[model samples]
Each structure stands twice: as C-alpha cells, then as structure tokens.
Target chain A: MLEDGNLVFAACIILMTAATYFTRAGGLFIISKITPPPRISAFLNHVPASILVAIIVPSLAGKGPAEFISAAITAAAAVFTRNLILSLLTGLICISTLRAFVF
Target chain B: MKTSTNKSPGTRVVFSGKGIAEGFLKCIPLGIGVFAYGIVFGVLAVQAGMTPLQAQIMSLTVFAGASQLMALELWADHLPVLALTATVFAVNLRHLLMGAAMRDWLVRLPPSKTYFSLFFLTDESWALSVREMASGRKDAGFFLGSGLCIYVFWNSATGLGATMSSLVDRYFRDPSVLGLDFAFTAVFLSLLIFFWKGKSQLPVWLIAGIVAWLFFLVLPGKWYIILGGLAGGIVGALRDA
Candidate 1:
C-alpha cells in the first residue's frame, strides 16, 4: 500500500515520527549535554502535575453536570480505594448510569 | 553527557528481567483502558478514510494517540506535511519535560539502555515509572515493560477497531453514551489524587485550571493545554524558588 500511491503520506508519517522521537529524547539529550539551572529543574518538577491539571481542567470545564459529579465521584473513589482501575470503573459506571437515567 | 553510573542521590537503577516482568504485570489493568481508546482511534481512522494498514503504520511509528488523531483531522488527498508534522511536535512537546524528569532515574544507565527505554515513553508509562521510582523501587525496566504492555493492547485494539469499524460504528454512535469519552479524564482525575502535594500546591492547580479554561475559550487547537500547563509550572516554580 505504501509502495505506489502513498509516497507523500508516507513522507508525512516519517516526518511525524522524527518530530515525535525528537521530543521524547530531546529533554534527556539536552540535559545530558549540560546541567540545567536549579529553577529550570524546579520547573520540570512541577510540569508533570501542572500539565495533568491543565489537560483535565479544560476538559472538565467543557462538560456538564454528570461529568462533574462523576469526576468528583472518581476522585473520591480513588482516594478511598487507592485503586486506579476501581476508581475509573466507578467513574465510568457513574457517568453511564447518570447519562442514562438521571440526566 | 556527564553521567555517573556510580553515584545517585538515592536508589540504584535496577534493570533486570524480574523488574521488567513486575512492571509488565502491574500495567495490565491500565492496558485494558488503553485498549478502549485504541479501538476508538481505529474506528475513527476508518471513518476518516484511512485504510487499516495505514492506521496501524501510524500507530506503530508515531505511537502517540493525540497526535495521530490530530493527523486525521488534518488528513486530506495531499497531506499538509508541514502542518501535520508541526502539530505532531506541538502536541508531543510535553514529552520534552516528561523525558527530562527521567534524567535522574535514567542517568545511571548506558546510552543504549537509556534511549531504548526512552523510545517507548508515553504518559501512562511515565506515570507508572515515576511512582515506581518515587516509592524507592529502582527498576528502570518498569518504564519499558509497562510501555510494552500499552503498546500491545493499543496496537492490537487498533487493528480490531479498523477491521470492525462498521460494527463499532453501528453499535456505538456516540462514545459519550458509553462514557468512553471520559476514559482519559477519569485516569487523570485519579492521578491528581496521587500527585496532590497538599494545600501548598492548590494555588498552582487552581491557576493551571483557570488558565486552561480561559485559553480553551480563546485559542484554537492544543495550545491551551501547553500554555495552561506552563502557566502552572511557572507559578509553582516561582513559589519554590
């Protein structure tokens, strides 16, 4: 399939693959070459949770009541059970049920 | 590249079959969640006019779900090569920070080991590895092993979704109806519990969430995520500094 008609598409894939691999390896590649300043390292430390929150907030804000309630339920389930899968299951079930019957 | 395999602040990096196996086994549950997304992506790719083979190739090579889905949005008769690749870079820019966080956890290993492990890095794998390392288990192999688990489920589900797109489309017209749309949100909401550093970090999250919401309203594409995440990171870093 990639042989005859898909050369441009294939090139796009290659470019994407290269660009992605760069991002994945670039941080270590740069850090290995030179030491990052303390503040920069601090920034990295905060980015993980910050990014997670950033991703979640916009998504959660865009949703409605069932979504908000389910998220709260999921967070509570996770804290109480200390189980990721169980909490996710609870959230999924809660949302499905609410969307079906309540909402 | 000045890395000392001889010394670290704490736990020694452990690379072994047992560690890898432990990582692999621990990730099975998360892998099931990943499979759901994979099937969703596969079904969408088919609808977007991609052949299953093409979708699998994209999945195998690019290996990032968000970027792949974005590519589909930008897909056309003649692909917008620059736009497609640029968006890929933008969406994955978070990885630069994530990979750097691995610096200490990975510095002790050889370049071969480091790069090999880094290639498989994804958000889920990185999360598991971070927790494992934080808990003082030194198995560097956990990153690779968990990533492999995700890789298996994600790719296999892609194939299944691509092949069975019709059945999925007919049955599940709206992923929201099944709450499949909330899978990642659910995953991240729960992760926030573990990442919660207490009231001290509340301001950072509050700022991040507010900034993200504002930008989501104003900007297009995935820029809000990056901008909002950076805003949180900057505020948190300033407080720490």
Candidate 2:
C-alpha cells in the first residue's frame, strides 16, 4: 500500500536504525572477547567525563556572552547543589532572563 | 560482585519494580529538558517535510537526539540513503564507547535482558546509570526505568510538536526565545560537574575539551565528539599506565 517515495524513506529510516544499533551494541561484543586491562578500565571510567566535556566544550567555545554567563551559572548551581533539576532550571531561567531583558 | 555470586539463579535477574520506580523518579528532573529537545526536533522534522507519522516513527525507532537532528537537516525531497546512513553512523559512534563503559554491569545478565535494556541507552540515561553505579546500586532496572521515562516523554513530545507544528512555531519562534535551546548544554554541564574528580580527571577533561573544540571549529560534521572522546580516552589510559 506504500508509494515508491514513501518506501525509500522507510528504507532509509530502517537502515539508519540498524547502523545506530550497531554502535550501541558493538562495544559489548568487542569487550566480551578480551579482559580489559586496568589502564583500559581506568580509561573507560574517565570516558563519561571526557565525552561530557566533548559535548559541551564546542557549545561553550566561540559563543556569545549570554551563553557563557548562563553556562557558568548552570555549572555553579550543579557543583554547589549537585542537583540536576536545580541546575537545569537555573540555566534555563538565566538564559531566558538574559535574552528577554538584559541582552 | 558479591551480590552477583551469592544470588540464586532465579534471583539473579536484575530487574526490580522498586528500582525501576526509583530510577523513573530520579530521572524526572531531567525529563523536562529531554521533552524540550524532543519538541524542538518534532517541530524541525515537520518543517523538514516529514509527516507527523514519519517524524514519530523516527523518534520511536531511532531515539537519538543529535543524530536525529542531523538526519532532519539532511532530509530532502528524495532520500539520500547513503549520506544519511554515514552521517548517523558518525554521529552515534560514541555509543560504542558508552556500551563498553557499561560492559561489566551489562555482561552479568542474560543476553536478552542485556540487549533489550541497552536499546534505551541514551546520553541522559547512561549518565544517570553511571551515577547510580557510582552510588553502589547495580540494578539494571534503574537504567531501563530511566530509559523508559525519557523514551515515553520524548516520543510524546515529538508527536505533540509534529501535530501542533504551527503552535510550536509561533511559541518557540526562536528556541532561544526562552533559552530552551541551552537546556541540553546546561544538562550536560551539570552532569559533567557531577562526574568531575579533582586533579585526576582534570587533564583528561581538558584534553577532550580542547580536542573537541578544535574539531568543532575545523570539521564539517560531528566527528569532533568521537575524536575528542578517543583522544581523551587514550590520554587517560596513558596517564593510568
């Protein structure tokens, strides 16, 4: 019942899903074969932090004052309270305030 | 480790109702940010020419934020399957390391439960699960539960965004109108702080940040994420050695 164009789109989605799944599950398959060395374990432990940094640094770099200030506020809130909700809310509120009124 | 060995076969299963509920509750705080991004993606997908159904199906099946966004940017009148596939693979390559990081915790369970639960793994849920593990809880249900909450929230928000694209367009005129655009970055920063250790992690974080920023400036796509992750990981390993 599907048209040719719709069928192509569907195929693309299916392929994309398969490729994404490979990345998600591939590590487990590889890790099963070898006992990860201590250094590797330590590296893996540090990976989450590194990945987080990787995701955020680009956004922080070469951005306007508004983004910088809001991110700084968000970081402070997170570090001081260690509450995810509070920090996110603080960032959202700060940015909105800055954009709406200040900037 | 003690828990794994001491438990009987029947009791070895990791899913628990209480743990699932706790995870769901713990994730509620971050759910808002996830929903916000989902709505944004939904609106963008509609604008990209996807029907509400196509956009919803993508969310249901893919469930990845950055890759989905990239896919929408690339979506056209004709499906450029090869380019889209490559872009998605490049964008999501970090998941390999994420899965590897959780290998010990995941390998304990049967393959069915392990893979099924992993299907829900995302940056947010994985970060939450890492926190849970740090706190000495090993319940796989926590991961699944967190994933379930975000999954439901994301899909529903996407549907809402797609169906109400016009309303979303008017309100979210600029995603930054209310700084909703910064929500994802804010959430990531908070999580980064949560996982920060003193001198030990500083070097690795710096290296990753620097490398990622450099790549972001120079590269055309999201290769920066993978590049930074690899560079930092290698440096961390060397430091440990």
The DockQ leader among the candidates is 2
What is the C-alpha RMSD, rounded to one decimal, of candidate 1?
A: 3.1
Per-residue lDDT tens digits of candidate 1, residues B33-107? 778888889999989888999999988889998888887898876678999999999988878877877776677
Candidate 2 lDDT over B1-241, as tens digits, reads 2122213353343667777787888887667677888898899999999999999999999888889999988899888999999998888888888888776567766677668877888878888787776656767778778888888889998999999999987886455655666887998899888887687888899999999999999996678877888889989999988
**Model 1, range A1-97, lDDT digits (tens) per residue?**
5464488878888999999899989988888877778888777777777777887898888689999999999999989998877988999999999
lDDT of 2 by residue, A28-83 (tens): 77886678889888788777778889989997787788899999999999999998
> What residue runs in model 1 are displaced by over 4 Å at the alpha carbon?
A1-4, B1-9
- The segments of candidate 2 whose C-alpha lies over 4 angstroms from its true place after superposition are B1-13
Assess candidate 1 and give its TM-score to the true structure.
0.90
Q: What is the TM-score of chain A alone in each candidate?
A: 0.87, 0.87
